[model samples]
Target chain A: MSDVTGGGSGADDAADSDDAAGADFDGAQRTGDVPTLSATDVEAGYDQHQVLHGITFESRDGVTCIFGPNGSGKSTFLKTMNGIVPVWDGTITYGDVDLTDEKPEDIVTHGIATLPQGGGIFASLSVEENLNVGAFTVDDADAIAERKAEVLEVFPALEDKLDQKARELSGGQQMMVSLGRAMMTGADTFLLDEPSAGLAPRLVDDAFGLIERLVDRGAQVILIEQNVRAALRLADYVYILAEGEVQFHGPPEDLSEEDELMELYLGL
Target chain B: MVDIGLFTQIVINGLLLGGIYVTIGVGFSLAFGVLEVVDFAVGEYVMVGAFMGAVLAPLFGAEGVFVIPIVLVVFFAVGALIQPLIHHVTTGDRPHPLLMGLVFTFGLATFLRGSVLTIFGPNSQDVPSSLLTGGIEVPGLGTFPVVRTVTAVFGVTGLAVFMYYLYRTRGGMAIRAIAEDRTNARLMGININRYQSIAYGAYAALTGSAGVFIGMTFNASPGMGLQYTAFAFFMVVLAGMGYLPGVIVAGIVLGLTQSFTAVYISGNAVLLVLFAIIYVVLLVSPAGILGKGEWAT
Candidate 1:
């Protein structure tokens, strides 16, 4: 794990710097030009029930994985960032944009795109139509066409199914369409929630591979995952969330050394 | 003692009338399918359209040929204006979307009906018939009225244009996407309010156009709104919600049934049989004839 972080290619570091710089909205002094997504005292919940209890964290570049047991406010945290769930208190800042109280559609325009757990793709729409819808904000037809080609290049399996409806695709393929749709926005930051929730073990790796590609392409990704092993493998920074609060935040190798973290929280 | 020639003519008449029903019903289907709003005031738009055509006929002359475009624009504007308010009421933190839609649209229908009553009074008014007063005689079949033929032609043209717009245009695709999954559509950055307004406006225009055709054939009365509304509802139910092609087929079928029943049986039995058909169709396939599977592609 140390070797993976240490042997990071120059391109990877450059991309990280670019994304980190993009996320530096506060104009705060930093030791390095690291792009970061910061949340301070974020208090939010769904109608009469409070879930997140003033949790705070700063995610810098690369893959920031948030993992927890069921009902640990992981999904809620992602939802709050995506603007699906209203933020009752606290602030969320990404790059030069203050994302607190922003509409979900507006959030996408700010280079932050979100993918929910399931049913993200328009089922009745064709693959081409889905891609078109993904680029709703992009008025230039040529740009949409170019972006679509780029997205399809990443998900080659969908190339042949452009005219096919999204509902007709396999479960893994549907997930791909969802991710591809988010990518079509050309967003710098991606908030993915339980991307591999119902995928087979084989498809799980494929999904992670796509995330790694996004990270490699200079996009900052904050992911919530149930598959701890796969998530830790790809994540640059890991946050262990339990009971609506952060219990651990460090590199994957550091978390692996703590035996209690493995048994108590992770059930490993 | 039923004349076969007369029976043939009745069938032809029914088919033409079905064309008018299709035009009116398509709007209702569109509203139900995409917006998921059962617009109870759909019939009121038809009444308003007929009234507008009647009022404009004398001024425009040429048997209100010019009134069609004017009525379409007016109805479209009215629809666009009212849609946002309806959308807010139906979608605002409501427990049941369908119930909210029903209540809101029902209220709208009542209000519109009252307005028309106050303005037009209870008396039925006639539209100018100078444009399509003649009939074309067929070789084997009986003479077909120029009015029914012209109205049927216009109806078909309207349906074709609407279908083309829905299947071909980017706006149409967005509308279909919303109908499929609204949340996902919003996630894709498709503006829900704007699209809803556009769709409702188009629907109103189509229904209003049907009203012009209806006014030329029959009396334009404030009370006549409910009958067209019933026809549209019956047709939509028969076709299945959100299925465009099915609405067309159902409209024609219902029209034929009404025409044939009115001729052979009794005029009163037209609605009774139509309702019975709707009941049976629902029991057999709750999703309608098209099975509510895909948007009318």
Candidate 2:
């Protein structure tokens, strides 16, 4: 297994070392703030098959990345959090509010927004229109406008293409629109599933940077990524899920120490 | 050789007929486009509207023109009420939404037609109003019936309003988003059921208005529902599923083709020509004229 603090190219090496140092210092004195979201013994699945069985985790106030293999229920776990999938048995709490078996639309009102896989951008709609739809739960016009401005500031590329159809945009640009739309909701916690699923390497870096920026702006970002190495670099905390359960939960440096987890499970 | 005057009359007639087809077909197109459900009872709804206008004409007197609003409201309510039931039955684990919609709405068509037959009998009934029996003479070309011209104007205006609403309004955007992808629309905090019900109501209003026009221009009979239904289906298919503007253009083309065939060939040849056109169009572009296969959901 590669060293957690030193691997990849020069740029990645710098990022990895920085992440490791941050993990070491932060792990010694973890913040006392209440977790934005907590799941306990959460069980969920599609029709007949249960994909997430008795899984549990707590997402603190930063970028928490969930990394796993293909059938490890990472997507299902995100869906369960967003109330798209019903929890067979377990409790999902946002702050102190119980969120078990709630409707997905209602969940947005509680300040939890989700950007599902594939970006979920409305293809036929214009970029501005897509953002408008994202603010559906918000009634005040001024607030929506303010959030739109804030989102545009974060994604300057979308500022020029506000009137263009989302489908006309490139894959990375569409992902920007999707992220921008989610930001328009002004939610404190964002659940992003595979934000960099099919993008060029440079765009992937850009996506990770944007996600990190969200954390800097005081939003709790929970992300699921297939790119293990980049995820370890960007994640403030990491959870390695396999076979519908969490096998390891720690900082990025701790993840590197688990030889079996890094080699066999993650294929790092 | 055809006389220029006669040719002009034929063209005018074709366009006017196309306008009526547009009114009748737009609702069908919307239902299919947004909901992905073929509303087989659209023609029955039209027939119901015509019958309502005919029945209420005497009570409203020459002011029976006021009945249009009432017809629109009542039909919209009826559509909203029935849509949920249709959605519930067709959207579960048993069968695909399209197949279930076809079976359910086909049954609804038969039920509605039977109800009309039971109430009004098989005889065709004419709507008794000045709005129905009048004409305006045009210079050089010919005189056109006031009812047909009014119907055409209203149809075009309604279609224009619907198009604007779909592309510009928030609610319309929600509907279009749902049409594009139901899961994503829901994720965006759009209540899919409410929007779908509203869409059904809007569709009903359009078809009901078309029925009133049909009743005023032609006589209303229970069996005429099937003919209008067939024509609406043809227009929708020709325009391509979910392509709104294409439906309007296709309606005009179909109307013109039908009119020209009836005048030059025979009235019976209209269906034959329509089927042949549909076959050729499907063979060449399975997505219809302007359809890019984007709104498959």
True contacts kept of 2: 0.67
User: What RMSD does each model have against the real structure?
Assistant: 6.3, 8.2
The two-chain DockQ for each candidate, comma-separated, is 0.51, 0.55
For model 1, residues A1-268, the per-residue Cα lDDT tens digits are 0011211223454544543343221111222333456888898887788999988988767889998899989889887887778899999877656889887767776666778777388887888888777777765554456567678777889999999999899988888788788876656677888888878878888888988877766677899988898888888888888888889999888998988987888888
State the local distance difference test value for candidate 1.
0.80
Pairs in steric clash, model 2: none
| Stretch of 10 with least lDDT, candidate 1 chain A | A1-10
Once superposed on the true structure, which residue ranges of model 1 sit more than 4 Å away at CA?
A1-35, A257-265, B1-3, B59-62, B292-297
DockQ of predicted candidate 2: 0.55
Q: Give per-residue CA lDDT, model 2, range B1-297, as digits (tens).
A: 878887877778788878878867877887776677888999899898888888887766743456889988998898898888887876655557788889999999999999989988999987765745667789998778677787788788878787787878889999888888877787778888899888899889888878888788777888888878888878888888767778888889887888789988999898888889989988888777666533332
Clashing pairs for predicted structure model 1, backbone only:
A20-A34, A20-A35, A23-A95, A25-A95
- The interface RMSD value for candidate 1 stands at 1.4
- lDDT (Cα, tens digit) per residue for candidate 1, span B1-297: 889899889888989999988988888988987778888988888888888888888875657546898888888898899888878777746788888888998998899889989987999998787868878999789888899998899899998888888878889888888887776677677777788889889989989988888899876999988888899889888887777778888988987999899988899898899999999988888678877624233
